[model samples]
Target: MEQLFSKALSVSVRCRDSEERKSTIRVTIDLQLSPSAVHKRNLHVRLTDDKDPYFLFTLSISEEDFQSLKAQQGLLIDFGSFPQKFIELLELCHSEQEAESPRFLLQLCSQGPTPEGPSSLSVVETNAFKHLNHLSLRLSPGSDREVKDYLASCLARLKEEREALELRLKRTEEDLSRQLSCTQQTLCEKSKELEKLRSEWTSQTSSLSSRYSDELQSEREKALELQRRLQEQADQLRQELESAHRSSSQQLRSRVGELEVSCRELTERKYKNESAIRDLRMKLVAAEEEGQRSKQQVLSLRRDNSLLDSQVHEKERALSQLQMRAAVLEQEIKDKELLMSRTKDVLEATQQQKVSLEENAVGKDAQIKKLEATVKSLSEELLKANNIIQKLQTEVKSLVGKIKVKNTVTVSQEKVLQETTEKLQSAEKELHSSRQQLGTKEQQMCALKEQLESTVQKLNESREVLKTNENVISWLNKQLNERQMTRATAPEPAAAAAAATSGAKSPLYPLGRATLPPVGGALSSPADLRPTTQLDVAALDSKYFERVDSIPIYGLTSHLPKEIPRPAKASLPSAYFSA
Candidate 1:
């Protein structure tokens, strides 16, 4: 077996001795193994086929009637069955080393007839090796399937264990929370009992204090009334005794009157002292009532303060619970943050690995992108080339349209560039001129700067002038308004003044011409004259004087101008001279 294993010896044998023996063969074995040590002629193996090679096979042995056939295997292989055995061997292979190295297997299988004698095992092995090449591929279906099922079972068991642990933790937490709630309810019942006790105690204390205060007040009132009654009795006795003493002393003793007067004075002082005592007792009663009210109020405040303190304690406990909850929440947040950090790190690592892989492929990708760009450029070039070819072929319409657009664009660009260049040149020249202008402007600016002070002085002078003019206008407006107000108040006096000036001389006047005389010798002044057009005052001496000759007279005095025309010389009415 050792020499055969070293050379990968193959052999085949066919059944020829007994047809029934070959027909009875139902199991086959073809293995691939490498020999560890081939020195032992009679080997003791712990596993079946340990001396041979382990290979896949189909054994038609009944479990109820099986012999220990594996230990005493001998050469009885059929070459026709060898193919089925070799493929079964390949499928049953468990190790990579066993499958990769094509080790020869001993044929410890069913007996088969052969042409040669017992020495024909070598030929059988050779035929078996050649035939096994065909059937080796059939091993694929069954051999590797078992390991997958086994691994799946192991993973399922592990997952079940984790789920059970999670369920247990959840149950524990629920139990703890239930216990905490029961504790809190018991505490609440206890606090309620304490509050009831305090309420009963405080109520009894307040009632007792109020009753004591009332009893004390009644006693004080009774004492004050009795003292007042006694004072009234003593004053009556003193008055009666003084009347008796006075009557007796009038008859017998005038010196005893002084003694009686002094006793009356003493009684009066005692009455005043008793009244003061009564007032002090009343004040004490008032103070006791006020103090009792304060005591009751203090007791009420203390009870309220206790309730508030208990409420504050409850609030503090609630705050502590909230703080604990907050701490838990913070811990949860931290856990979430830690999980996120780990996840982020994992994600970043994955991304970095992806980036590294991408970087590893970057040259290829760049090449592909470049190829794609080159392909696009080539395609574009091809299109351009095609267009040029079309142009060469005199497809001028499309080219002309493109050329027209390009020409327009070029023209506009050229115009814009030319305009910009011209503007730049003009700006440069303007800059030079402006530089020169700046020097001239500097001199003018200095002159203007000096003139600015004088301008300020002039502006100040004008402002003063404007102020003065405003004051003058204000004064004049006041006078004018006053005059208008007086005229409006006495328009009849103005008319009367005008009439008197027309007919009579004024004594309190400044000018002589402003008034007319009572006699008709002098002509009326302009004040009395009727206005026609503008008066030719400078040119007139006699036109007005000559017109006066025609006036009509009233009792030999003319009121109108004296040159009164004779109207048809009817007899004069006597009414004309009645004045």
Candidate 2:
């Protein structure tokens, strides 16, 4: 019995349901011989077929129970014969608590056999099995060879599963490395495309800037030419106006002087004719008194002849002499009357000539007043035109400053062009209004027709120049719009390239949707685009054109150049005559 308990024993715990189907739980039990005590021994039981080798349990059997188990080892020992002892031993060694209550059968077979068979089978009674359903223990193996063979097979299976897992891990790593290389190649290609786009953009910007600069230079030259021509025309008009005014004034002065001299002569002749008429009236009155006295003398002579008839021959000779004297007096009286009528006709003729001369002087004075009023109006218009020009120049300067500040922003450029167009339109309206005023002034100035005609021709030339300037401005606007359209279209490919390259490392491709620095550090600064220079040229051209528009249409005396003398205001003819 001691030798039997000391050796390693094969233990199989089988569970059977109500239908008697067995699921075996195999383990090994080691029962070592106790030298200190014969009554007790430690029974060690460990699972063999399970993956966990440490699944084990230990049980201690008392001296009486061990002796009974030893006494029944070679015989058919039934569990029902010693139900309490077996149940206690099984409870101590049962490691799986999850198994349900089922019928248990414990069978112990020894290596040495009886005459009946090589090993004896032990079974538990039905009544004992009902209470011992948690465990079923069977010790069947007699040697170590079977346990060694089972352990070897488990070791080989574990080694094969480990190798299979290692191979799968290696394959997954290779797939990841291939994907990484492919991503790197895609990033490199995207970077190359971005660089190409940047180069194209740079070239396009440079070409557009050069074209814009050339156009601006040509327009500036045209504006300067127009300004010089307008200045020359203005100078010529001023000279002509001055000459006409001087000559007209001198002629008016001379004509007024002649009229004054004639008036003085007429007045003097009137006084002389009155004196001659007075002398003739006195002569006629004296002749009439003499005739009355001659009549009285004849009456006295006739009375004396009647009284003294004796001396009749002597008295008749004296009476004949007196009658002849009376006939001579009558002839003299007729001649005096004819002389008085001739004097009266001469006085009437002198008075009529004086009246006609005074009417001519009044007409001349009125004409001088009209001429002076027209000159004043023309001067005022010129002053107003000058003021408008100054205002336009200031506006242009401010716009230029704005362009300089916001040179990179295209919207500001558009706004500047719009403002310029509006200012030009306003200037055109002012020019039209000024032309109407000039037309009215020309009609009033009939004396200066040739001068007005020359001025009108100059105005027409200015209008043509303005039209050309407008055309240039429109062309510039179209170019600007085209440039803006190009700039708008230029960024799409770059953005796409940036988005494509975003997946690469940040140090390799630094571009983003918001900020795209030039690839490979090629561009030094923003100024290389030349937008500022182009805007400057545009501003200068606009300023020059505005200056050309500023020239006064009606050349004012106050605004005349230093070389040209201004005409003096004409004075009334009456005042000149009076002075």
For each candidate in turn, give its C-alpha RMSD to the true structure in angstroms: 70.2, 83.0
TM-score: model 2 vs. ground truth = 0.14
Q: How much is the lDDT of residue 115 in candidate 1?
A: 24
lDDT per residue as tens, model 2, 1-579: 222222122233322322222323443444545666433454534333364432223233444444456454642443233334543444433433234532334333334332111332234423442533333333333234545555666678778888998898899889889999999999999999999999999999999998899899999999999999999999999999999999999999999999999999999999999999899989989988998899889888887876677567568877887888788889889988998999899889989988997898899889979988987977787677768777777887877777765444557677877887788788878777877978888787874766667656655655554565666556545544443344445545754454335424342322221121232333244323332212333222232244322333366536533332122224322210121
* Model 1, TM vs. native: 0.14
Count of clashing pairs, candidate 1: 24
Task: For model 2, name the residue pairs that clash.
Answer: 39-63
Best by lDDT: 2
Which window of ten consecutive residues has the lowest lDDT sum in model 1? 40-49
Whole-model lDDT, model 2: 0.55
